[model samples]
Target chain A: MSTLIGVDWGTSSLRAARLDAAGEVLEERSLPRGILTVPAGGFPAVFDEACGDWMREPGALALLCGMAGSRQGWVEAPYAGCPAGFADVAAQLTWIEPGRIALVPGLTCHEHGVPDVMRGEETQVFGALELLGLQSALLVLPGTHSKWVRVIDGGIDRFATFMTGECYGLLRQHSILARMMPAGDGELDAAAFVQGVHHARRSGTLLHAAFSARTLALFERLAPAAVPSYLSGLVIGEELRVQDLRGTLSVAVIGAQALTCRYELALATLGVTVTRVGSQATWRGLRAIASTLQGTS
Target chain B: MSTLIGVDWGTSSLRAARLDAAGEVLEERSLPRGILTVPAGGFPAVFDEACGDWMREPGALALLCGMAGSRQGWVEAPYAGCPAGFADVAAQLTWIEPGRIALVPGLTCHEHGVPDVMRGEETQVFGALELLGLQSALLVLPGTHSKWVRVIDGGIDRFATFMTGECYGLLRQHSILARMMPAGDGELDAAAFVQGVHHARRSGTLLHAAFSARTLALFERLAPAAVPSYLSGLVIGEELRVQDLRGTLSVAVIGAQALTCRYELALATLGVTVTRVGSQATWRGLRAIASTLQGTS
Candidate 1:
């Protein structure tokens, strides 16, 4: 039986799973994976500490995804264009340390004349497809740069990136919206979110209407704590409206549980059907990519 | 001749002028203001210390403006509605210590079901009217909450407030825009600002589109520093676009020296004629209001 290592290295955390040839996770571990924490020469040590036990037996091929493959990661892998299949990503793979280590290439989407880039989430989307038995569907990976990717026949057809998480962080930490909002763990105002979505849809320009948040606060004295949630709804609603996703297939959201819930709620408000997928999809997808590469799937 | 006192208490600084029976500046002094610096009970002591030498005389009527009259300040004054001449604010005045101390009421405007409130800046606008010797025109007070006030025949007819300064602060301090932006004292980016204005005018729904700053950084690889300037242009441009300035006689921006210049440049891009008024306008306006009370100008 062949053994595989599936690695998901995000901005702040890293998770790796050890799986048998059948794609069943034999063991898994998570650790701090942010670039700030891992120095240039420290990745090897960190990786060894996390997955050393599994690799000791030999014949274990490791597949890594996310920021670990970015320019700042263990090895830089160029982005593969959308309409790119698993084989395209496989073809562009870079070997970090010869036959034992392989890194997945991130995906890029050129839509609306704007080039959208993804690193770790692409692997998860691939994993999601494998887990759900989806041949073609819309996959939504909600995060700092939330991505809406189109999957068609085991290939990434197209995708669009929204700065939803980044914007939320900006508004909360820097803008006056921060003053009005309270510090809590992902608490949101559903009613305000709904209203924001409606407003974003009706408003002609999304950016111009953002000042209305301050306007609402100054005029109506709306509670500050609700501003962040309202902003989230506005951005997401505007994305949905601008993208014209009226006839898209059921949306599959992949992220942490809390983020998935928020995306789910926002999409539900728009009367769209969505399914929640976990981060484990990336692991399965990595294994699947390996299986396909070895001609053993 | 009735003696009067004019006080301008802003977020971070407080200036009080003691006037003789002729509304002349008998003596003026300034101190650290802001809620953080002056504890609730410390307002009176700070005020007295700043203006005590001039307050030695008896029966002086005091008029206060700015954050001092905010909910968190010396006393909270209820908002007076637009077309809200001096009479409306005067009517809703809350005398902290009647006769000895009186707070000048901030102006409020309600148009198309939208309400905007202003405190210290209104005094400056009123002062600008006194100084400029004009009654009807667009008064642009450029600051954190940039107020575009319409003065018709010696009365504040209507106005709108834009969070230009606050947004600038947030973008510089907290957003990815901060990465490329210079420190707070950084110079202007003429090209980036112009592009920002053009982009803002063309983009629809600013709230959603505001994230374009970060998107521009990630996708277009625009320098992080240029982001704030771009955001500034976008916001100022949106303000200009939304405002109904088609028939206005002229635009007068009242603020500090540097900000006034930026406002001039922004307005110049739109090919609109504008004038820059100095910060002294607030003092002059306070004097004018005091002159009216004392039957002297």
Candidate 2:
């Protein structure tokens, strides 16, 4: 029985998991070494440092996902076009050490002549599906770039990326709205956040809605501490506002607890139920892909 | 026949015009000394430096507009509630040297319990109306914060502020999309820009439409030099999208030529006509208010 060392290496951080043959995680480790921080040609060294011991084990197969497979990573794994299933993705893995180490080719889909690509979230989507036991579902992986994905018949149908998280960070830190917010992170003011969500619907566009963060504070209506929460709600709410959530019963929220919680609240406000999934989806997803590749080999 | 020193002082730069009794420009001067750059109690010095010679003249009353009236500027100029015209704005002016130096009280309007205020744009809105000699029209002042104003019966009825410019600067300079764009300002790619404008409508929200700027580049569909123009179109297009341009035949675009030209192209794409107005609207606006104040005195 071969052990699988699955890694979810994104732009800012890396997480690795060692799973047994049954796809159960036996141990896991997280590091600050996201692809961006890794020095040029240092990916192999960082990978070794992350799970060198696990790699030393005979019959150990490794699967890496996320920005690690991007153009800037160790090796560029070309994106697999959408409507891709576990088998489809497994077949497209770019091998680093043939028959031992491989990288997952992220998924891309086109709409109206524009291409939308996801490096790591595709793996998590499949994992979320398997964990939730759903053949088709709408999954939202909210992060720096929030992905609204659709799964049908155990494959990623199509997805859209909203720069919600990144925009929020820019507005909170670099934009004029930052001047109205407190110096550091503040407690999420639930009421203010809800107000922002609702305001987004009324404000009509994020470009206009974002300014409310400043005006609300300027008028003494929203406290400076609550500005961050309000701004978060505005961006999140804008992200949700564009999607046609009508008749959709529930959405699977994937990411860390803090981020997922915010999405959950925002979704709940719009009368949509949410199923929470942890980062374990990444490991589970890589495990599924590895298992499929193993069977094919 | 008294002369008026009309100042358009904003966050980044200050422009002052010494106008004769006929409102014709006698002398014009612009400095890097904006409200933000003016040190504590230094506005007077900077103001003097900008137009001290003009201010030294007997009966040279001064009318200042823009951020100079904000809480952070020379003195906090409380916003005058809207439906403000030349007379209304003149009445609310905060006097610095009683009847000699006054700051134009910018306009504020409320909708759905949210307040939208403009410090500098209100002046431009009035000036745009006066410049075009129209009692009622839809005017757009595009800049760091774009304003869509509806003029009715020669008064500033109500307006909405879109943080389009500021958001564009933040995204172009700080966001991930910046990585794909060339380091310096790129020439406007007319075709790519038009595509971006049209894409904004299809993408449904700026949050989503912005990601296309990256994906299009990643796929090599959009040139690196064209990214900035495309982004400019996306934000400007989104600003135009939310407005009910149904019956608006023509929109008076008041701003710098570079910005107004972009707005003109975008508005033209949407089947609306645009009349370009210059920054002179600020001076004209203040002159009108000063003239109104002089008549009353």
Candidate 3:
């Protein structure tokens, strides 16, 4: 049995975890050195600084995911089309150091002639599946860009991406709606948020629904403090509104607590059960793929 | 008959018209002096700079609309509730001067307890009515905040606002989708724009539809020059998707050419007749309101 170094490198940050052959966490590190900050021809140095020691160990393999596989990252790893499984992803790795370090390819799924792509998230999806011990599940990973995924027979069948969080930040900070909101962040107001979620149901579309944040403030019906919560509810609710959650017994939500919690509440309101998976899914996902590469490496 | 000065002062720009008793445009001036750019206690001075000479004439009445009546503008004119007519708006005018000058009040409509407010658009709706000579009509004013107005019996019955333009700008310039797009403005690609509108119909929601801008570009299905047009189509299509345009015979689109032309195309694609009214509607609407103030002033 050999060690594995798992790297989840995204647009904004880089994270790494070292796992023993048993897939137990041994050591971990996180840094703001995301792929975007790395200058051209500098990913090798950054990679060395992050986990050169771990890679020096005999027969220790490294698997990198997320934007690190993007065209602008260390090396461009072509996307694996869905329905892809662990073996499918493992077989497509772009080896940085032959048989040692490789970039895990992202996933691309086509819908209505348009291509939807995901980098590190595909790994998180696989990790959630591994942790929850489910060969098939419905999953929603909410973030700057939220992905609603479908897993069938132990592989990713198809998925959709929604710019819910990015839209929220843009409206909350840059749009006219921001004028009525307070400068800094506010705690999530449950009641206001629920009201927002309900409003989204009746408001027809987000383009129209988002305007309520302003009117709600102007009429003194929503406090300055609760505007953010309400806005969050609108976007999150809209995200859920477009999803065909019927017959969806339970959805595995993989993301940070703050975001998944909002999805949990919205889904619960719609009578859908939710299971949460955290950042660990990224490691477990990388390890799962790395495990498949065992002996072959 | 008394002379009339019609001023449309909004957040980003100011325009004024000196009209004869017959509602003919005698003189006109446009400046970059929007309410947002005006210094504190500077509305009166800026107003003077734009149309002071026109106002100095004996018995010349001024009716200013748009953000000039907003809380942060010249004077905080209370919004007139729908179903409000010309008379209702005229009655609520915030008098900057007893009889010589006044700020036209905006209109507010309620839907399921949430409020939708509009300032300058109200004037444009009335002006569109005057130009089209229709006592009842459905009009859409496309801008930063697009308004879908319903006028019945020569009054604003009810309206809804969609953040279509603002959302398009935010996504095209600030979001991840921007990364795939070219810098600066691009010419409207009719084919790409139409494809986007059709795609929006199938995408279900703008949140999901917008991602296609990137995906379409990534797959090389959409060119960089056409990304903006595609995005614009997505938002505008979404805006129209939520509206109950079933019973409408024709929509009066009042806006600048670049915007109204797009709306014209989208609405036309939906098999709805579109009647475009230019910015002159503001002056015509104000003149119509001033005609009623003739003897009283």
The residue-by-residue lDDT of candidate 1 on B1-297, one tens digit each, is 556678888888888776664445767777776654888678888878776665566766678889888777887877666786655555566678755677778777654443557888778887787678887778888777788888888788887666667766665676555665557535678777777777666554344345566557766556766766777777777666666667654599888887777777777776777787886676677666665554321
Count of clashes, each model: 22, 0, 1
Q: Please provide, for model 2 over B98-155, each residue's C-alpha lDDT reduced to its tens digit, 9 standing for 90 to 100.
A: 8789888888999887899998888887777888899999999888888999989988
Considering only chain B, report the TM-score of model 3: 0.97
- 2 against 3, candidate with superior DockQ: 2
Per-residue lDDT of A208 in model 3: 94
Q: Candidate 2 on A167-255: residue-level lDDT in tens?
A: 99999899998887779876778888888888998778998888888888888988888889988889999999988887899999998
TM-score of each: 0.83, 0.97, 0.97
Root-mean-square deviation of Cα positions for candidate 3 versus the true structure, in angstroms? 1.5
For residues A112-180, what per-residue lDDT tens digits would candidate 3 score against the true structure? 768999998889998889899999999989998899999998899999999999999999888988888
Evaluate every candidate with DockQ and list the scores.
Answer: 0.23, 0.91, 0.84
For residue B52, give model 1's deviation from the true position in Å. 2.2
Docking class for model 1 is acceptable
Please list the residue runs of candidate 3 whose C-alpha ends up more than 4 Å from where it truly belongs after superposition.
Answer: none
User: For candidate 3, what is the TM-score?
Assistant: 0.97
Candidate 3 docking class: high
